[model samples]
Target: MFTPQGPTLRELAVQALSSVERGYDLLAPKFDHTPFRTPDLLLDPVARALRELGPYETGLDLCCGTGAGLGVLREVCAGRAVGVDFSAGMLEVARAGGPAASYVRGDALALPFGPVFDLVVSFGAFGHFVPGQYPDLFGQVRQVLRPGGQFAFPLPAPPRPGSRGYWAMLGFDGVMRVRNAVWRPPFVMYYRPFRLGDVHRELGRAGFDVALRALPELGERPDGSPRCRLVVATRRS
Candidate 1:
């Protein structure tokens, strides 16, 4: 769903047909107004979790579209915060809003920084990557982080089977699979593949010591499990 300020249906259709980079560039102007932007509901809790684990300097926000996660970095990092994305359009909007950080246009899989950051965080951007890309993606994050630095993101629990949310995600991913099969320059956003178990294993393989911290503010499921968790992956020293 989108606000009046967000992109129109026509705009969205055009974006859906483009490559991920071009699609995001097209959407970047009105992105914050869309449901796609990481809301404060998610961002605030991630900041809280990071604060408990951090006294960090030099933070980086990976895939930092319009700098939604930059505020989290600013809140938790004692030193400077920086945002990086492949989209120049997103960085342009982010700079104009003055999100208290520097912006860099760079690919997530091949970051252009040394291991200089004490913390790295991402929000609402993982769907762009497929399962096989996890190792490379995590490796890039680790490469840009100092020893003992953390790479963190929030992971919401999967929707229960037969639930409306479950069907919606399954349908969306199904549509994307068909679209990519037929379309050139495929847009690659899918919600189903970023499972917690798979991600934990990949993070470990990528040389991170992974831990999950419950975010109680998001509340709990009927079974008393957390609705969301912050995946805190520390670069192995």
Candidate 2:
């Protein structure tokens, strides 16, 4: 679901054919108009949750494409705020439209910073990282956060089994699997591997005391579970 100003079908096709970095670089200018950008509906709840948990001094947004999460950091963080992304094009656009904050071009797996941040937030970027890479990714976030600092992100509940959404996601992942198998410079984006149970365990392994906060603004499932949750992982002091 894209807007009229979003990337064209041909543009999206080219992006899909390119590597993730190059693809985002190509899509950076029109990214906010695409459904791929973290919508304000999701970002608002996350910002609310962070405010209740914070008064944080400095904040960092990991893989902050277009700097959507930077706005949340600006709301909750009292002092410095920063957005880091691997795509120079994305960072350039972020610096232009995003809130006043520092923008750094850096890979999420090898963050170029010290344990200086009090809070870190990411949105819609987890799917870019495969399961096996979770350890290194979480470790990098941990490495940049002060002890007792938080690494937070919103995670939506999986779709109901046999539902259209479920089938759609499964089909998308299947296509991606086939594409990666045959393609070069594979674009790693898959939803199946980023499960809550597995992520909680990995966060523990990465030395974070994890907790989930319900984002009631997103509503609940038919079974009464939160439709979305904010995973707040605090580094152990």
Candidate 3:
């Protein structure tokens, strides 16, 4: 599911074997060319949702790989837009563009910034974190946000059981589990474990007042439920 500009099959294999940081380092150069990059189709609706919640002064993009989410921050924030990630290679690529934005290389679980942001957003990066790590990750995001500030991101409804997409994700995570059991430096990207109900509890435990907004642009399921939602988690004033 990659373009000619993306990494080769062999390249992907090497990445899977390496540590998560190193894998992204090698993949960073061609990340945008791969299906891994956050698509503009999704970003547009997320930006629309943010505009409704904002007129923010400063914004931060958590796990902002390749700076794709930085544009959303620039669109909503009136002041500075910043991106932070642990991957130096990703930050290098992100920094070259987005003149209105600055980049920082830091762990997501332990961010360096103060509560300086009026808004925080992330895209296509949560799968990298393990389920247990959600609390720490969300805590870090809250720490970097001002009181009454928002931490928002989009979440898609899980694929139906027995669906091709469901099987695809299940297979991927199964392989990952096997790899981590047999290999060094586990690459923790799994799709199925990130359920919305679990996340709502985690965000609440992390001290956020959480709510969900339907993104109708992504369309609806047969049951008329939204396929995607904008998770708006606010730090209490």
C-alpha lDDT values of all predictions = 0.93, 0.94, 0.91
In terms of lDDT, the best-performing candidate is: 2
Q: Point out where model 3 deviates above 4 Å.
A: none
Q: Candidate 1: how many backbone clashes?
A: 0
Clashing pairs in 1: none
| Candidate 2 ranges beyond 4 A from true positions | none
True-vs-predicted CA distance for residue 173, candidate 2, Å? 0.6
Residue-wise C-alpha lDDT for candidate 3, range 119-213, written one tens digit per residue: 99999889888899999999998999999999999999999999999899999999999999999988888888888999999999988999999
lDDT of 1 by residue, 99-204 (tens): 7899999999999999999999999889999999999999999999999999999999999999999999999999999999999988899999999999999999
Poorest lDDT segment (10 consecutive residues) of candidate 1: 1-10
Q: In terms of TM-score, which candidate is stronger, 2 or 3? A: 2
The local distance difference test score of model 2 is 0.94
TM-score of 1: 0.98
Instruction: Write candidate 2's Cα lDDT for 109-202 as tens digits.
Output: 9999999999999999999999999999999999999999999999999999999999999999999999999998899899878999999999
